[model samples]
Target chain A: MSSTEAQVKEKKRGRAFSHFKSLVMMQLKDKLDLSFLTSTKQLIAKVVFFVLRIAAIIVAAYYIFYYSAFFSIFAIIAWVPPIVMALAFSIIFILSVLSCMVGLMKTLFFADDNRVLVTMPVTGNMVFFSKLVVYYLFELMRSYTFTFPLFIAYGMVSHLSVGMYFWMAFVLIFVSALPVAIGALLAIPAMFVYQFLKKYEPVKVTLFVLVVGAVIALIVELIMLIPENINFINDWPLKYRPSVISFIESAKTYILPLYAITEMLIGTYENLTFTLKPSNALVFLYVLVTIAVVLGIVYLIAKPLFLKMTAQPFEFEKKEFIKAKENRKRRKYKSILRKEFLLNLRSSISYSFLAVYIAVPILILLLNKIYAAMSTNILGNYMIYAFNLLIILLILLSSNGIVSTMYSMEGRAGYMKKTKPLDMTFPLLCKIFYNSLFSLISIIVSIGIFGAFNSSSIGVGGLIMLALTVLFFHIGHMVWSAERDIMNPQNEQYATTGGEINNPNSNFMTVMAFLVSFAVAFFSFILFNESGVNPITACLKLMIIAMAFAAMRIYLFIIKVRLYYREKM
Target chain B: MRKSVVLTICVIYILSIVLVGYLGIKLAIFDPILYVQSIELIDDPYSDSYKISHPPRYPDQDFVVKEYSKGLKFRLYCKVMPENATNKEVEFIVNMPDNAVGKLQITSDGEVSVLSDDFDILYAKVYILSKDGQKARSRDFTVQINNFKNPT
Candidate 1:
C-alpha cells in the first residue's frame, strides 16, 4: 500500500481507540464532576445542604426501620411482590432498551440533526455511537433514580457481607451497561431499516419494529408474572420445579452480565460447598438465539433498502391551486382554538408524547386489573386512588415543561406576530388557548382512566380535583410565559440546560400559581361537600370555576402581551 | 482552601465521635446481657395427667412438656391409659433458642407406646399415651438446658 494510504489506516485505528476512550471518560466525568461546587462559599453551602438532605433521609429511614410498626408491615408486604415485579420489569426493561433504540434511530436519523451530521466527515459509526451514548445516559439516570435506593435499603436490612456488597455494586454497574449493549444491538438493524425505507415506507418498518417490540414486552410481563399463575398451567413439567427453573434461567440469560458481577461480589463460587444448581441457562440461551435471529432479519432487510432509499432523489410536485373564499369571518376565539389544535396535530413529536402520556394511565389501570385478578387483596380500591393521585401530581409537575416548551417551540418564526397589524392579544390568546387545550386533554384522559377504575363518589371527587389541578397548572403556565422575558427565544426549542433561570419573577410566579391552585382545589372540595351537592354536580361546579380562572388568565395574558410588545428585547 | 479542608476534617471528626457515642449508648442500653435470664418454671403439685380422648380429640390439646435443654439430654417418662387405644405413637418436641442443638428421650411403661422416628422436634415436646395400661404415671422432665442465644 502507498505510504499515504497506510497513514490513513493508522489514523483510522487511532481515531477509533480515541473515540472509545472519550466515551468512557464522558461517563466517568458525569459521575465525578463537582462543578456544582464552584466557589468555596458555594461549596460549603452545597455541602451543608446535601448533608442535611442525606441526614434527613437517613433519619426518616431509621425511624421507619426502628420506630414504626406500620413501616415494618409495609416493608414485609412490599418486599416479595414489588421486588419480583421490579426484577421482572427490569428484565423486560432491558429488552425495551432495544425498542427505545429503534424509536431513537427513527427520530434521530430522520430528524434535523441527521441533515447536519450527514455532510460531515464523521463515519456512520461515530454518529451512531454518540446517539447511543446519549440514550444510555438517559436510561442510566432513570434506572439509578428508581432502583438504587431499593438496592441500598436491601443491603442495609439484610446486613450483607462485604462480598455481597461488592457483588451488588458490580451488578448495578453491569445492569446499567446491559441496556446500552442491548440498545446498540437493536439500533443497528433499526438504522439499516431506516436507510432502506425512505419516503414513509419506513413507517411500515417502524410499525413492524414496534409490534415486535410490544410482543416482546408482553412476553416479558407474562414471564415476570408467571409464578403468580403457576397453579393455572396443568403440564407436569411446568407444574413443579421446571417452571421456576426455566424462569430463573431466562432471567439469567438476559442479565448474565449482571449475575456474573453479582456472583463475583457475593463469592457465590467460593461459598458453594454443597451442590449448587443453576436453572436459568435455557432461558438465557433462548434470549441469545432470539437476539441473533432478529439481528439477522434486520440486516437482510436493511442492506438493500438503504442503497435504494438513499439513491432516490427528492421531488416536489405542483398541484392545482384552489383557495376557499372566506365566508362570514369566524369569531376570533374559535379561530384561535382551531389554530392551536392544528399546531399540535402538525408536530408529530408533541402529539406522540401527548398520546403516550394519555395512554399511560389507561395502561396502568389495565395492569391494576390484571394484578387484582392475581392478588385481589394486594391490588384494591385504595391502590387505585393512590395511583390516580400520583397521576394528577405528575400531570401538574409536567405542565410547566409542556407549556413553557410550547412558548419555546414558537422559535424565531413567531416574531412575525409583532409586525402583524392584528391585536397583540390574538397571539397571546392563541398560545394560552393551545397550551390549556393540551393540558386539558392530558388531565381529562388521565382522570377518565382513573374514573374508569374507581367509578364512585371518590372517582368523581378525584376527577374534580384533577380538573382544578389542570386549570391551576394552566393559569400558572400563562402567568409564567407572560412574565418571564425570553432572551434568544430560539433556545427554547432545545431542552432547558440548567434547573435555574435568570428571571426573578418566574420563581415567585410559579410558587404563587401552585399555592393558589391548591387552595382553589381545596376550597372547591370543601364547598361542594358543605353545599350537600352530588359529586358529579360538585365536579361540574369545580370545572366551571376552573374555566373562570382560565378566563381571568386570558385577560392577564392580554395585558402581559401588550407590555411584552412595548418592552425592549 | 486550607480552612475548608480543616473544617471538613473537623466536621467529620465530630460526626465520628457523635456516631460512636450514640452507638456506645445504644449498645449499653440494648445489651443482650441485661435482658438474658434463665426462664424458670415452678413445679406445681396440682398438675395431674388426665386422658381427654383416645384418638386425639382436640388439635390444640397435645401432651407437651414445658421446657427442654440443648444437647446430649434424655428424659424418661412412663404413661398408662386404657387398653383398647389403637394409637401408640408418642410425640417429643424441644423448645429452645434458634441456635440450640439437642436430642430427646421418652421411655414408655410398656411396649404399647413407642417414639416415632419421623418427628423433628424443635419447639415443644408431645407424648402420645397408649391404652396398654400397666398402671404407670408419666411425669415430664428436661435436662442439659442451655441459655437462649440472641442471633443479633
Candidate 2:
C-alpha cells in the first residue's frame, strides 16, 4: 500500500480502460459497416433491405395475431397481444443465445487480432477483461439492432406506455450480457469438441453439413407446423387449447432476461409509480448476480487458458509442412481446379452451400411429407410440382453468392493471375465448374425425389422439365454473378479487411435470389394451372427462359472477361 | 477426373431428355371431370344436417312439397369423385314416375324433402349429374313415409 505502488496500479488501470475503449470503438465500426452508406446506390439498396427486414418482422407478428385468432388457439381475440409478445420474446432470447455463443467463442478465442493484443504493454488480465468488455458491447449492439424492430412491432401492437417502452430498451442493452456469460460457459465444452473435430477433416465436414442442414430443416418445420387450413379453427378440437395459454404464460417466466424485464417493467409501470416490487427487484438482482458469477468463473478459467492458447503457435503449420514435403504437382488447370475444390471441402462459402445443396433433396422430401399430410389435393399436380421447384430454386440460387465472391476471395492470388500468362476465362470458368456440377446433381436428386413420391399425382415429365429449368438457371446465375465480380473485383478490400468488407455483389445476389425464385415459381405455376396447358408445356416455357439467360451469360462472360481483365491490368 | 465429370453430365443430360419426352406423352391438358363417381347421401357426423357449400346450380329443382301436413325438409349431401377431376360440381334432379304415391322434391345438392310426416310410401328416382352430363343415381331412393316423422 505504498504511494508509488498505488500510483503504478492506478496508471495500469487507466491504461486498461483506454485499451477497452479503443477496442470497443474498432469493433463497433466494423460491426456497423456503414461503408455502403457512402455510395448512393448501396445506401438505397441497404435502406430498402432494412425496411424490408422490419416489415418482415411486423408481417410475422400480424400473421401470428390473425392466425391464432383464426385457429381459435386463443379463447378470445383480445389475448393476441400477450401470445405474440411471449412467443416473440422466447424466440428472440433463444436465437440470441445461439448467435452470441458462436460469435463469442470466435471473438474471444479466435480473433486474428488476439495475438497482437496479447503482445501489447498491458497486463494479460487487462487484455482478457478488455476483450470481454469489447465483446459485451458487440453482443449488445447486435441484440439491439436485431431486436429493435421486434420492440417497435410489440409496442405498436400492444400500445405500451412510454415507461414500458423505455424498460424494453434498457433490458435490450444489458440483456445480451446474460447470453455472453452463458455462451462463455458453453464455449468451454464447445471448444474442446471443436479441437477434436479439427483433427479429423472428414468427420468435421460431415458434422458441419449435418448441423447446417438441421438448422434449415428446423426453421422450415417450425413454419410448416402452423395449421394451413384447419377446419376446426373457429371450433378447434380442443382440450389442449386452454393449455396453450398456460404454456405461453409459463414460457414467459422461463424466457430468461425477458422474464426479469417483464417483472421489472410490470412493477415500475403500475399506477405510474417508480417504485419496484420487492419480488420483481429480487429477479433483477438475480440476473445481475448470475452474470457476475459467470464472469468470475470465466476469468478464473478462460482468461488464463486463452493466454496460453494464443501463446502457442498454430497447430496447422506442421501438417502444412509435411504436405509440402510430399511435392505434389499437376497441370495448371488441374491444380487450379483442385485448389477451388479443396477450398470448398474445407468449408468455405462453397462448402456451406454445398452442404445445403446436398441437404435440399432430403428437405424437399420432408416438406413433401408435410404437404401430403396437410392434404395437397386442393392444389393440382402442376401446382404441387411448381411448389417443389420453388423450394429447390430458392436454395440453389441463394448459394450463387458463393460464386459472386469467388474472385475477390482469392486475395493476392487474384491479381497475380493477371500477371501470369494464364487464360483468364478458363480459370474463371473452372471456378464455377465444380459448383455447377454439385448444383446439377442436387437439383436432379431434388426433382427425382419429388417426382418419385408424388408420382401418382405429378408426372415424371414435370420433374424432368423442372430439373432442366433450374439447372440452366443455376449455371446462368453463377456466370452472371462471377462476371460481376470479375469486372469490378473487391480483392483489395477483402485483403485489407481480412474478407470482412461489405460485399455488394454478394448482397445483390442474395436479394436477386429471392426475387427471381418467386417470379419463376409464380409465373410457371400460373401457366401450369391454366386450362389446356400441360405441366410439360408450362415447364418447357420456363426451360427456354432459363436457357436464354444462361446462353446470354455464357456469351457475355466469354467475350467480356478478357476485355475487362486487360482494362483493369 | 474433370473429363469424366463432363462425360457423366453429358450422358445424364441426353438420358433426361429422352426420359422426359417418353413420360410426357401422357401429359394431357387439365384432367377433365369424367363422371359423378359417387353421389353419397349420408347424414353429417358432426351435425344431423349438412349445410351445402355451393350455390344451387339447379334452382328449379329446389322445391317445397306444398299441401302437406308436416315439416319434413332434409338436406342430403352428394359426394362427387375421381378426386383429381377438374370441376367436380354437381346438380341433382328428381325423375318422378306418374304412379308415385307421395309428393317429393329434391334440391341441386340432393336434399330430399316433403312437408307431410304421414304419406304413403314414396319411391322417387334421384340423379346426380356433373357439368359434363355424366349421371349417377342413388339406388336407395325409396322413403317409407306411412308413419315417418319429420327428422329435421
Candidate 3:
C-alpha cells in the first residue's frame, strides 16, 4: 500500500526479469545458435536430422493413437479412463525426466559462467534461479515437441472441444516441471558422487558405464518378461508371477502424482461433456495442491545446497611420471594404435564414446534374446533374415561415428599429428584398427550370445561371411569419417554455455555417414538376400559388395591424406 | 529462413503422421483377419465312457475326446477376402490321426472335410492353403471314437 514499498518490489521484479532474459540470450548464443553449424554440409545434415526425428515422432504418435483407440472402446466399457491415462502419462513423464536430467546437470553445476557468477554482486540464489528459468524454457520446447502430437491424436480420436484443447495446452506447460525438479534433485547427488570418485577416473568411468548398462539390461529384461507373465496370469498351471505383479501394483501407488494429473484432465473433460462428477473436481484440486507443495519443498531444499554442491570441484591427486619397462615388443602401427586408444581413454567425451562401444553390443544381444523369445514358433525360417539384419544393425550402429571425430577431438593438438615423423596414412590406419577392435568385439560377442541361446546355428561359414562383411564396413566407415575430418577438421575449442563442447561439423558428418551407410546396408540386404536366393550365396555376394566399397573408401582416404599434406606444404 | 524451414518440416511431419494414423485407424477397424476360431469334439457315449474309465488323463482338457465317434466332423471358420474378388483358390490339407484310413475332401464350393474309419482319440492338423497367399492352420484338434465291433 506504501509507494516506497511498491517501488522496491517493482525494482526487484524488474531485476529478476532482466536476469532471466540475459541468461536465456546467453544460452542461445553459446549453445543453441544455428551459426554454430559453420558449414553448409553440417547445416544440411542438421536439417535432415531434424526432419527425420520429427518423422519418427510422428510415426510413434500414429501407432500410439491407433492402438489406444482400438483398446479405448474396451477400456470405456470398463470405465478405466483415469487409470489408462495415468499409465500413459506417467510412462511419458518418466521418459522425459530421464532425458532432461543430463541437461539439468549441465545447467546446474557445470555451466561455464558459474565461477564468474559466484564472484559477482548478485547472490547465488539469483544465479540459480536464472539457470532454472533457462532450463525450464528448454524443457518447455522439448515437452511440447513430444506431447503435442499425442494431444492432437487424442483429441482427434476422442472428439474433444476447443475449450479442452486450451486447457490441455495449459496443463502441458507444467507437465515437464515435475520431471525437471526430480532430475535436478537426482543429478545433484550424482554430481557429488561423481566428484567423490574422481580420483580413480578410469576405473570409475568403467564401473559407471557397466552399472548403467546393467540397469538398462535389467529394465529391458523386465519389459520382455512382464508381458509373458501377464499373459499367463489366468492360466492355473502357469501361475502368475506374484512378485512382479505386486511390484507393479506398488509402482502404481508411488506414481499417484502423475495419476492425479491424468485424472484431472479426463475428469475435467468428462464433467463438461457428461454428468457432474464432484470427485473429479476434488481430485483435480488435490493434485494441484500436491504439485505446488512439492515444488515449494524442492525449491527450499535446492536453494542453499546448489551453491555448495556446485562449488566443490572434482579432485584427483597428481602423480609424477616414471619410466617403465616395455611391456611388449610391438610394431610401429601397433604403437600408434595404442597411443590413439590412450588418448580416447583420457577424455570424458571420448570415454563416453567407448562406453557406447561396449554398451551397444550388450544392448543388441538382450534385444536379440527378446526377439528369439518372440519367434519360437517361426524360428526355423526366420532365423536367417533375423541374423543378417541383427549383424548389420549392430556393426553399423556400433562402429559409426566413433572414429569420425577422432582427429577433431584432438582440437589444437591435431598439429602434433600432422607434423609427426611418420607416414600420414599410417595414423589413419591406426585409427581404423582401433575402431575395428570395438567392431570385432561386438560381432564376436553378438555371435556368441545369439549362438549360445538360440537353437539354430550361425554356421562357421556364415560366421566367416558375417565377419568379413562387418570388417569391411568397420574399415570403410572409419576411413570415411577420418577422411572427412582430415579434409575439414573442427579444430576450434568451442564451449557451450553449459560447459559442454560441440564439434558441430565432425559430429554431423559422423552421424550422417552412419545413417546413410545403415540405410544402404538395410536395403541391400532386403534386395539381395530376401529375394528367394540361397542365404549363403547371397551373403557371399553381399560380402563381395562390401569389400569393393571398403576398397574404394580406403583408396579415397589415402588420397585425402596426400591432399592434406600437399595443401599444408 | 531457418524458422520457415523448421515450420515447414513440422507441418510436413504432422500431416504425414496424421495421414498414416488415419489410414491405420481405417485398417484396424475394417480389415478382416482370417484365423481359426476354435475346434470342438462331437459327443458320443462310448468315447466318454472310455475316457472316464481311464485313470491317467492322457488326453488333457484341450485335446479330450468325450465321445466315441466313428468319424471327426469339425466346422471350418474363415473370413473371406473382398466380395468382388472371385475365383479365390482355397485348399485344405489334413494330416489324419490314422494315416491309413483318413481321407481329405474339398467340395466344389471350397468346403473341407476329413473322413476316417476308426478313431481312438485321433489327432489331426488342418492346414489351409489359399491362392491369395493368405494361410491359416488350426492347432491339433482331437477326435475320440472307435467303430464298435459287433459280436466278433
Candidate 4:
C-alpha cells in the first residue's frame, strides 16, 4: 500500500536485473571469446570447421533417420522407432544432469571467481540467480549445439512441417530445464562428496575405480542383451516379445516425462501432418508442470544452499591435517621421485587421468571379451591378438603423454631445478621413471590378463617374450617423449594460467598413440599371417628389434637432453 | 588490422579475398541430408502385421520341428518402402547360441543355408543397407528357417 516501500522494491529488482545481464555477458565473453579469430586465415579456418561440423551432423542424422542402417540395428534389438526416440531423450537428460551438476559445483563454490562475485555489491541470491540463468543459457546452447543441426539435417533430408520444427524447439527448451533443475539439486551434495574425497585420497581413488567398474558392468549388460541364439531374435526367449512390446506401448502412454515427450513428438504424427492432437496439449501442460515443480524444489533447497555456500564453502570441507613427517635420511633421487608423485597426486587433472590409466587393464580386458564374443567371418586369430596389443599400447602411450608436460608443469618451481647445484639428469630421471613405472604396471597387467585368459596358444614363455618386447619399446618411447618436452617447453603458459591450454606435446602424442598402435598391429598382422610364422616366433623377432631401439633412444636421449638442460639452466 | 601481427598465415589469395571484400561465400548448404520423408522398417513384410507360424512357436519359446535334411537352402525376401526405392539390399545372418554345435550360413543376398543336421530351428536377421555408392544402404532381416523338403 505504501508507494515508497513499492519504489524501494522496484529499485532492488532493477539492480538485480542489471547484475544478471552483466554476469551473463561476462560468461559469454569467457566461453565464446573470438579475440583469437584475428586472421583472414583464421576466419577461413573457423568457417571451414563450422562447415565440416555441420556436414558431420547432417551425415550422422541422415544415416540415423533416413537410412536403413538405423532401422535394421533397432530391429536387431527388437526396438521400434518410438523406443529409439525415448532412449535418445533419456540419454540426453542424464548427460545434461551430469554436466549441470559438475558445472554448477565448480562455478558456484569451487571457482576462484566465486570470491570476487560474492563480494560484489549485490545480494548473494542475485548472484546465484544470474549464474543459474547463464548456466541454463549455456546448457540450452550446448543441447542445441548437439541437437539443432540434426534437427535441421533431418528436416532437410526429409520434408518436415514448420510445425514439427516449432514443436521440437518448444520441447527442447522445456525438457532442457528439467535436467538443469535436477543438476542444481544434485550439485550441493556432489560438492560435499567431492570435498570428502579431497580430504581422503584412497577414497577418491576407490570411488573412481568403482565408477569405471560400473561403466564396465553397464557395457557387459548391454552386450549380453544380444541374444545368443538367432532363433531368439524375433521373440527373444520366444515368449517375452509380445509382453515386452505391450509394456513399452503402455509405458509410452503413462511413463511420466520420457513417454509424455515421446508420445507427443514421435508416435503422434502417423501421416507426417502436424495436426495438434488434444493429447499434445495435455503433454505440453505436463511438461510445463513437471519443470515448474522440479525448479520450484531446486529454488526451495538449492538457493539457500547456494547462498550459504557462497558465504562459507569451507563448511563442507572436513580438513584432516596430516602431521608432517620427521625429516629422515633418504636418497636425493628418492625424495625427487616422491615429490613428483605427490605433486601429481594433489593435481585434480593428474589425479583423474591417473585413475583412468589405472582402469585401462580392466577396460582392455572387458573390451577384448566383447571382441572375442563376436564371431567375425574374415578376421583371423592373429588379428585378435594384434588388436589386443594395440589397445594396451595405445592407452599406455596416450596416458604417458603427461610425461611430456612433466617438467613444464613445474612452472616457477622449475627455477629451483635451474638454480640448485643438482645433477639435471636426476630430475629428468625422476619425471621419466614415475610415469614409465605407471605404464609398466598397466602394460604388465594387460599382458598378464591377456596371457592368462585371452589365448592358450601364447604360452607363458611366449607371453614373457611379448612382455619384454613391449617393456623395452615403452622405455624408448617415454625417453623420446621426455626429450621432446625439454626441446619445446611451455613453462610460462602452464605456470601462469594453470589451464590445459593447447600444447604441441599433447597433440603430437595423440597422433603418435594412434600411429604406433596401428603400426604395431599392422606389422604383427603381416609378420604372423603373411609370413605364416607362429605367434611365439613373431614375439621373439619383435623383442630383438624393440631391445635395439630402446638402447639407441636411451643412449642418444641421455647425451642430447643434458645439453638442453644446461641451456635452460 | 591491429591484430594482423597475430595471423600466422600470409597467403596472397586469402588476403585478396579479404580485400575483394567480405562477400559471403555462397555454398549450397545441400548439405541436405541423407533423409527419407518416411521410413518404417516393416518387420514382417508379409501378412498385415507380424504373425508367427501356425501353432505359433517363438524361437525363444517352443519351435515347430518340421523335419528337413542337411544342406537344405531357401531364399528369404523382404521389401522396404517406396516400392521403387533403388537399394533395398539386405543381409541375413543367423546369431549362433552358446551351445550351438551346428552352424547355418546366410548369404549377402539373403540365402539361408543349413550346414549341420545337429540343430533344430535357427533364428536369422537381415541388415538392409544402401549401396547407393555415394552412400551405402542396407536392410537386415531375420527369417523363419524354411527347409525345401520339410514335411509340414
Candidate 5:
C-alpha cells in the first residue's frame, strides 16, 4: 500500500474514534445534567440537604418504632389507615414522578430537535440509547429523593442486614423505573385510542361507559364482602389457611419487585421452619414477562407512534368570529391565561397525569372504608385529619407545573404587554387571578368530596379547617411568586435556556411560607378551643380569617403586579 | 358548548345530593344488628363453667364465641354501649342473676374478696367455692376482661 493511502486510512480511523468518544461524553453529560447533582456546588448542597432530611426521618422513625405501643393503640383505634396510607402515597409518589419524566421525555423527544437529530450521522439506535440513559438517570435521582429516606427508615426499624440494604437499593431503582417504562409502553396504545377517539364524538360516551362499568364493579365487590357465603373467608381459619398462603405467594410472585428482593435478603429457604417461603423464580418470571412486553411494545409501537406524532403538523381550527373578536382588543393578559389553561387541559400527558393523581386518593379512601367496615373498629377523626393534610399537600404539588410555567408560558407575546397602553398591574393581576382560580377550584373540589364522605365524622369544624388552610395556601403561593421574582418571563424556545436557575432565596421563601401558614392554622385551633366555642362557631371564625387573608393577598397581588409591570422584560 | 357543560355539572351536583339523601334514608330504615342471647358454660373435668345472659332489650344482638384459652380469652358480650355513655368511658354494674346459690368473690382495682353480706350491689364478680376450700371459680361481672381462661 502507498504511504499516502496508509496515512488517509489512519486519519479516517482517528476520526471514527474521536466521534465515538464525543458520543459517549455527550451521553454522560446529558445523564449528569438530568441528575440532582449537575455541578460541584449542587452536589455538595444536595448531599448536605439529603443528610439533614435523612437524619430527621431517622429520628422520627426511631421514635415511632421505639414507642410503638402508644402508636400501636392509635393505629388500632384508627384502623392502621396511616400505615396503609403511607404505602399508598409511596406508590402514588413513584407513579407521579415517573409520569413527570414521561411528560418531560415526550416534550423533549417530540420537539423540533427530532428534525435535526433524524438527519444526523447518528444511528436511530444510538439516539434511543442516549435518550433512555438520560431518562433512566432522571428516574433514579427522583426515586432517590422520595424513597431513600423511606428505605433508610424501614431498614433502621426492621434491623435489616447489609445484604438486605443492598437488595433494597437494587429493588428500589428497578421498581421506580418500572412504572415509567410501563407507562411509556402503554402510551403507544393509549395514543392510538386517543387518535381514533379524536375522529368521533362517541369517545365521550365510551369514556362514560367505562367509568360506569368501573363503579358497577366496585359496587359488586362491596356486595360480595357482605354476603353470608363469603363471611367464612373472614371467619374460618382452617378453610382460609390455603387461600391466605396462596394469596401471599401470588403477591410475592406477580406484584412489587420488593417481594423478590425481600426473599433474597431474608434467605427464604433457610427460614422454612418459620413458614417463610421462596418465590424468586416466580418473581423473575413476572419481571421477565413485563420487560419483554415493554421492550416489544416500545420497539414495535412506541417508536412508530412517536415518529408519526412528530411528523404530523398541529392543526388549529379557529372559530372565525371568536378569532376576530380576540384580535380586536388584543388583550394579551387574557390571551396568556387562555393559552396556559388550554395547554394544560388539551395535552394528553397532563390529563393522564391529573387522572392518576385524582384516582389514587379516591382508591385509597375506598380501600380504607372497606377495611374499616370489615374490622371491629371504626376509622377516626385523626385519620380524617391526615387525609385532609395529604389532600392539601397534593394540591400544593399539583400547582407546581402551573406556577413554574406561569412566567415561561408568556413566550414573546409577553413583550407586547410591557409595551402596551395598559398598566402592567392589570395584566399581572389577571395572570395571578387565573392561576389562583384554578388552584381554588381544585382545592374546593377535593375538600368537597372529603366533606361529603366524612361529614358526620369530619364535622363543620373540619370543613372550616380545610377552607382556612386553602385560603392561606393561595396567599402563600402568591407571596412565593412575588418573593421568588417568578414573574420575569423567559422565552423557552431555546433548549439551553430551559435549565432552572437556582435562587438561593427560594429556600427561605419556602420555609417562610410553611412556617407562617402552619402557625396561623395552629393559632386558629388554639383560639377555637380557648374561647369554648362550638365547632361550627370556631369554623365560622376560621372562615372569616381565611376571607381576610384572601383579601390581603388580592391587595398584595395588585401591588406586585404593578411593580413587575414597570420592570424591563 | 360551555354553557351546556356548566349546566350538566349543575345537574350532576343536584342528583348527588338527592342520591345521598335517599341512601341515608335506606340505611336508617334497614338498620341491622347481629343477635346474641345467653351464654351457656358447660362443666367438664378438663374445663370450668360460666354463663352470661342479656335482657330482652337488645334482642337483635348476637355473640360469636372465640376461645383463646392459652392467651387472652374471655366471654365477650357484643352489645352496643348505652347512648348516654361517652365512647371514651364505660361504667358497668354487675349483679348475680337468679337460680345460682354461691358467695361470689369480687375484684375491683385488683382487690379481691368475697361479696359482703351487708351490701347488695348491681355489679359484682361471682366466685363459686370448691370442696377443698381452694378458690376454683370466678367471674368478672363489672370489670373489663384483660385476660381470661376459656371454659368452653
Candidate 6:
C-alpha cells in the first residue's frame, strides 16, 4: 500500500481508540465516583460502606481457604484438584453471566446517560464496545475474587511450583473474557423478553417468577454438583446422583470454553515444568479462538440493537381509567396503599423485582428437595438452623428495597406528598403496610413449605416462632427504609439533571441485612448444636431477640415520622 | 454540628449493638468442655492409621480398622484435650460376637486394651463425659479390630 494511505488508516485507528477510551472512562467515573457528597453524613456513609465491603471480601477469602483445605485432603486421596477447579469454574461462569446480564441491562437501556451518548458523533459500535470493556473489567474483578483464594489454597496444598503460579496468573487475567462475551450474547435477548413482558401485565409476574425460579434452581444444582459432594450420590436412591463427573463431562461437551479453561489450569499446574502439557496447549488454543469468535459475533449482533434499544426510552404506558363511584368510598389509608400498589405494578423494573421477591419461596422449596435427597437426619436439622435467616434476607431484598424507593420514585411529583393535606406518615405507613403484607404472606408460605417438605426437626412451634420473627423484622426494615426516604428524598432532587436512579441509602440497608442474617444464622446454628438447649426453646429465644430488635427499629421509625412532621419542607 | 452529633451517636449505638450481639452469640455457642483430640490403632507395626479429632457432635466416617496376627494384642490409643483432664469421665463400650471373641478393658485414661487374641475380631465405642454435665455422652466414636494371620 501507499505511505499516505497507511498514515491515514493509522490516524483513523488512533481516533477510534481515543473515542473508546474516553467513553469507558466517562462510564466508569459516573458509576464509581462518590464525589457527589456535600454533607458529613453522606461522606461517613460512603466510608463505612467501603470498609464493610472490604471486610466482606476478607471473610469470603478466609472461608475459601478454609474449605479448600478440606477439599485438598480429598484431592490427595482421589486427584480432586481438577474436579474442584471444574466446579469453581462453573460457579464463576454462572456468576459472571448473571452479574453481567444485570449490569448490561443497567448500562444499555436503564442508564440515564445513554440518551445523550446515542446522539453524539461517535458510532454505536464504539459506545457498545466501550461499555462491554467496562463490563469485562467488572466481571474480571468478580472472577478474580472467587478463583484467587482457591488457587492459592490448591497451590499451597499441592506444593505447586513458581512456574505454575505465574502461568495460572497469566491464565486468570484472560479467563473472564469468554464468560463476559457469552453474557453479552444473552443481554439483548433478555432485554427483548423483559420489554415484551412489560406490555403484558397479567402474565408478567407468573412468567418472571418461573424464569427466576429456574435460574436459582440451576445455581443450586451447580453448587451441589461439585466433586466434594459427589460422594453423596453414591448412596442416593435415584439412578443418577447428578454427579460432578457427569457435570464435567457435559461441560467439556457443550460449554467448551469452561472445559478449555479448566483443562488449561489443571494441565499447567500439575507439573513443575514451565512447559504446557499437550492437552493444555490444545485447550488453550480453543479458549483463545472461542473468545475471539464469540466477541466478534456479540459485537456484530449487539452493535445495531444496542443503539435502537437504548435510544428508545423504557416506557411503561400509563393506563387511564375513569374512577368508579363504588371505589370512591374506600378508606384513605387503604386507598393510598392501593394506589401505591398499582404504581409499582405499572413499573416493569419494579414488577420484575417483585417476581424475584416471590421466587424466594420457590428457591427454598428447591433447596429443601435437594437437602432431603442428600442429607441424613442430622444434616437436615442444620438446614433448618439457617432457614429463618435465609427467608429474612430474601424479605429484606424483595420488600425493603421496593418500599424504600416508594417516595423517591415520585420524581417531580414528590411535592404532592409535602403539599397534600394528608398526614405524611399516613402515606408512608400505607406503603410500609403494603410491603409488609406481601412479605408476611411470603414468610407464612415459606414456613409451611419448610415444615412439611424439608424433613426439618424445627417442628410446628419453631415454624410459628420463625414466622413471627421474620414478619416483625420485615416490618421493621420496611419502616426504617421508608423513614429514610421521607427524610431524604433523593431521586426528585436530581430529576432535572437526568442522572441514574439515586437510592444511596438502599446499599446500607442491603449491607445491614447481610450482617444481621449472617450473625443470626451462624450464632443460632452454633448455639443449637453446642448448647444443650432444646431446638424449639433455642428457636423461641432467637425469636424473642429478633422481636426486640424489630421493636427498637419501630420505635425509631415512629420517632422519625413524628419529627418529619415537625420540620418544614 | 448538631446533626453530626446525632449521626455520630446513632452510628456508635448501632456499632455497640452489633458488638453486644456478637458477644451474646459467642457466649451461647462456645464449647466449654474439652473433647477427644485424636485416636489411633497400634496393632499393626507396618501400617500407621489415625483419625484427627472427629466432629464434636457427629461421627460421619467409620474408624479405620487395623489387622494383625491372631496372637497380637489390639490396642487403641486416644488423646483427649488436656484442658480440665482431671475431672473428665471417659467410658469404653465394646460389642463383640455372641461367641465372645475378645476381652476389653478401658483405663481412667482413654487407652483401650482389647484381648482379641482369645478369638477373632472386635468393635468398641469411646464415650467421654464432661465435668460440667453441660455435655453428656453425646458423640461416641467407633473402633474395629480385625485379626488377620497375614499382614500385607
Q: Which stretches of candidate 5 lie above 4 Å from their native place?
A: A1-25, A34-115, A118-120, A129-267, A271-412, A418-425, A435-512, A533-553, A556-569, B1-152
- Clash count for candidate 4 is 23
Residue clash pairs of candidate 3: B44-B67, B47-B67, B47-B68, B48-B66, B69-B145
TM-score of chain A in every predicted structure: 0.55, 0.75, 0.73, 0.83, 0.56, 0.66
Question: In model 5, how large is the Cα lDDT of residue A347?
Answer: 48
Which regions of candidate 3 fall more than 4 Å away from where they truly are? A1-31, A34-63, A71-80, A96-106, A118-121, A173-176, A184-188, A199-203, A216-251, A268-284, A308-335, A348-399, A447-458, A488-535, A559-569, B1-152
Candidate 6 Cα lDDT to native: 0.61
**Local accuracy by lDDT, each model:** 0.46, 0.65, 0.56, 0.62, 0.47, 0.61
Residue A414, model 1: Cα distance from true site in angstroms = 3.1
What value does the lDDT take at residue A407 in candidate 5?
50
Prediction RMSDs, each to the true structure:
15.6, 16.5, 16.4, 15.7, 15.9, 14.7
lDDT per residue, candidate 2, B1-152, as tens digits? 12332344345334433333344224335444456566544443222344322225534332222223455455455455543334456666666678655677765644556644434445455555666455554443333234334343
**Model 2 misplaced regions, further than 4 Å:** A1-20, A26-77, A80-87, A142-162, A166-174, A209-229, A235-261, A267-276, A310-339, A355-391, A415-427, A449-458, A487-533, A544-552, A555-569, B1-152
Q: What is the C-alpha DockQ of each candidate?
A: 0.03, 0.01, 0.02, 0.02, 0.02, 0.02
What's the C-alpha lDDT at position B55 in model 2?
Answer: 23
- Which candidate comes out best when scored by DockQ? 1
On DockQ, who's better, 1 or 3?
Answer: 1
Q: Model 6, residue B30: what's the lDDT?
A: 35
lDDT per residue as tens, model 1, A1-569 = 99999999999999877875565455446545667656898788878986675555545544444432222232211112122233444565666576667755564444444444444565555544555556656667555554444444444443445555444454454455455556655665677666566545658668867975696577546634634322221332224434543455466567555454333323332111111225333333444565566545544554334333333443543444669867767676676667777776576545534544554444444444443333222123333333334334333443344344445456555665677556766665565565556656766766675565556545566576655755565565555545343322533333344222333333444444445544654555454545452455555555576667667765666676677677943
Q: Candidate 3's fnat?
A: 0.00
Stretches > 4 Å off in candidate 4: A1-16, A36-48, A66-71, A75-80, A149-162, A195-255, A267-275, A313-322, A352-359, A370-379, A419-422, A452-456, A566-569, B1-152
By summed lDDT, the worst window of 10 consecutive residues in model 5 chain B runs over B38-47
Per-residue alpha-carbon lDDT of candidate 2 for residues A368-418, written as tens digits (9 for 90 to 100): 654544333323445556666766777777778767888898887787777
